[model samples]
Target chain A: MSEVREPQSDERLQMPSDPYSVPLDKIDVAQPHLFANGDHWKYFERLRSEAPVHYCEDGFEGPYWSVTKYDDICHVDSSHNLFSSEPAIVLADPEEDFELEMFIAMDQPKHDVQRKTASPVVAPQNLKVLESTIRERVCTILDSLPVGESFNWVDRVSIELTTQMLATLFDFPFEDRRKLTRWSDVATTDPEQDQSIVASEEERRAELIECLEYFGKLWHERAGNGGGSDLISMLANGESTKDMVNKPLEYLGNLVLLIVGGNDTTRNSITGGVLALNQNPAEYDKLRANPALIPNMVSEIIRWQTPLAYMRRTANEDTIVGGQTIKAGDKVAMWYISGNRDEDVIERANEFLIDRPKARQHLSFGFGIHRCMGNRLAEMQLRILWEEIVNRFDFVEVVNEPTRIFSSFVHGYAEMQVVLHPKKA
Target chain B: MAKITFIEHNGTKHEVDVDNGTSVMNAAIDNLVPGIDADCGGQCSCATCHVYIDSDWVAKAGSPDDQEESMLDLNPERQPNSRLSCQIPVTDELDGLVVTLPEFQF
Candidate 1:
């Protein structure tokens, strides 16, 4: 097996200004800087048009085929049998010594068993119970934001709201709610690419172990309590996951999954929606005119953001995708970000239309058994956030270009300065 | 065209005339039915189009195929009569088909 190589951030800076200038075979969209610079779209645009199933042998994370077209991504994602999500779902392999075994990366029977146990917490029925709490939190967060002055929207609103939501889901100590945000960032942060959260792999693992130890205490406390609605309680009381306490790594893996799953994705979408709407003021006008479009706009925002860029799946057997042969054991990346913008699949794919018809038909939540479990929850948060924003603010003006995350896997904003213009009475 | 009756979780019924060969999921979507999301657009990929075939129409609706079964099995609320509406095609064999939308589409 070829070892994954980390492309230095500076190497990506040397990429040509024009994506087409790079030879077809040399185009590697997985470079984290491409995402950080927000220059990945043209590269994916070329791939979707020229080589939809193009392979990058010297990619930062070893060799992987990029599935960029809409239908092709759907085919690869839905065919879980042929394209397994085992070992790891990111382009790079998990460290052998400390592999976190989350259900999202597991195959069949085991995946189904573990996923069912935790899914109920975010299921629509439970979401109804959570709706009011979420709205109350949203209102509080929005109310606290500084008005008419530039502030980091990502920090004040996006991260704060999502962290509070995750804390409520876990019933974690309210005072330490920000710890969920830190752990979520630690879990997904690539030490090689960015050391903002942790200086090295060891530091990352150490922080996650702290996370494990903390959740372990919660698990023990709740395991014998019989029944409760929070995620920790659900896992503790769940038949399949009850014994997870014994498997420390597995227990931590799931906690990381739920945390990162609930946190970063929604956090980015909340920030992204504001940036998107500001970029397209007409859509903001449309939104102000009709707040009824909040639900549909949420889906459109998810599609436009494509928060998580791609999900890696290892081919279980030799299979053909987009007329190209993928050998068994080869890595394949279903670039949801690219597929969401494939013009053939999404009409005016490049444009950010607030009320696009069939807006929910995007690949952001993925497909098949491994599809996003927290999708409805993410949508609900965005919907409620927008509803409250429109009611209170006439405009959430983006004051500057947003600082994007420096990872291809997590396509999101790191910081976006915005000023809230209060709605006129 | 076949007549399809979609009953929401709250017991609201929407009767629509869906053309033959249109999926039950599409019929609900086309008619703007509230409960069925059909997120994957009738691919049987996402189970968002999940519905319960009214007890009377259970046998006629038939058992879900292997792919549909795999998707349906993921739903915690899966019942014996549960089926992904995307997998069910509207046909003349059953004109007055009634399906109840689940409280949530997970």
Candidate 2:
């Protein structure tokens, strides 16, 4: 079996000839082109209705089950005992030579312990302390925007702000903060497809190893000092994680987890919020009328964005979900993006309404024990940014459609050109 | 301001003065109370901030609404006086209020 299935050429990937007439087996949702070309929602909509628990005989990694319905996704996410997260949590299995074993991919006692070690960083007390710093950063970014001049919002705003926050969380060197963004992009981006992100697997590993080496120095310093509260210091000194340094790979795994955890979700959501607001001008007008809606609007943006589309789980035992029997060792991807758009669970699911009731009830942050720990932090970042945006900017006009990321897992934008208009003082 | 006491399952107590409109979950979060995870940040979505209202304060904290009731139903340790702390808004009437945290909150 092939390890990495290179995507077919674009000519073969045009809109399916009778999307309705296409046989169920011919429908492979793992096609990266569908995501890159921004045509995945229609495919997922068909799948959710036609085959909620459909099994794709040939996925990018291998054959797997696609749990598309909201309830079924919840069933899969909650039944962690039956569907283990170990080995890897994405569609592609970790490379045999350079495996990553983050705690999110672990089960039971280990997952709980390691999660507790990092949870304090996102705890509300800490978030409250970080809020002012976040606002200051947001102000600086907003103020520095090239007024009336078009620029790539993804790099100028999303990546910069998220990278700065990530650096603050790790207490990494401020000048080297962009390295955190690079490592985060490297951790998730497919080196083969996204050459701009990373050219090759060897280069990716070398860059990641560089990340490990840089953090290793901080580990020694933090391990020796009286232990600060940053994530690195916490991991270096926590009762459960203190000895992780001895296991270099595991330590690297956690670093990748924290960096990516702090990076993509917020970054894309920030960019996504701007795009959503631009796409739905009435919602933007409503937001402009009443900034109190920012909190709820932030939740809606996250729901609409649904960054990190699907998380994969390996079946530990044969289980039947929605009349489909997933055999042992089969990978099952809970299509959270589909579930977030499922009309059955969410009222008016496809519409982007800022005032939607139960706005926070989406699968974007995931569910169960493995729910995104940085969820509050992500929401806060969006909430604060919007608050700042409404206070200062008259509008952020989208120049054109965004260049979408070419990955099924990371449902996000690669770049978005925008022109900013500021409110006159 | 209202004074509320959060009691950990292990018998540790933390007292904080909270503004009237603030949530019990926010008060606990503000004071860094150990067990109130509040993972959803007072959205009433996650039940990580589950707390059992002390009998004396149950009348003031009132019952959780339907949305909170459904969320609390997911918690295995939920009790009759149980409320998702994020759903309970602090007020002058709730002064001297006490809520006992479930050990599972951590």
Per TM-score, the best of the predicted structures is 1
Clashes (candidate 2): 0
lDDT of 2 by residue, A283-399 (tens): 999998989999889989999999989998999999899998889999999999999999998989999999987687788987767878888799889998999988988899999
Instruction: In candidate 2, list every pair of residues with a backbone clash.
Output: none
Q: Which lDDT values do the candidates have, in the order given?
A: 0.89, 0.84
Model 2 residue B83 CA deviation in Å = 8.2
Which residue ranges in model 1 land beyond 4 Å of their true spot? A1-14, A194-196
Which candidate wins on lDDT? 1
Candidate 1, position A370, lDDT: 90
> Model 1: per-residue lDDT, tens digit, A8-69?
44443345657988888877888878888888988998898889999986677777899999
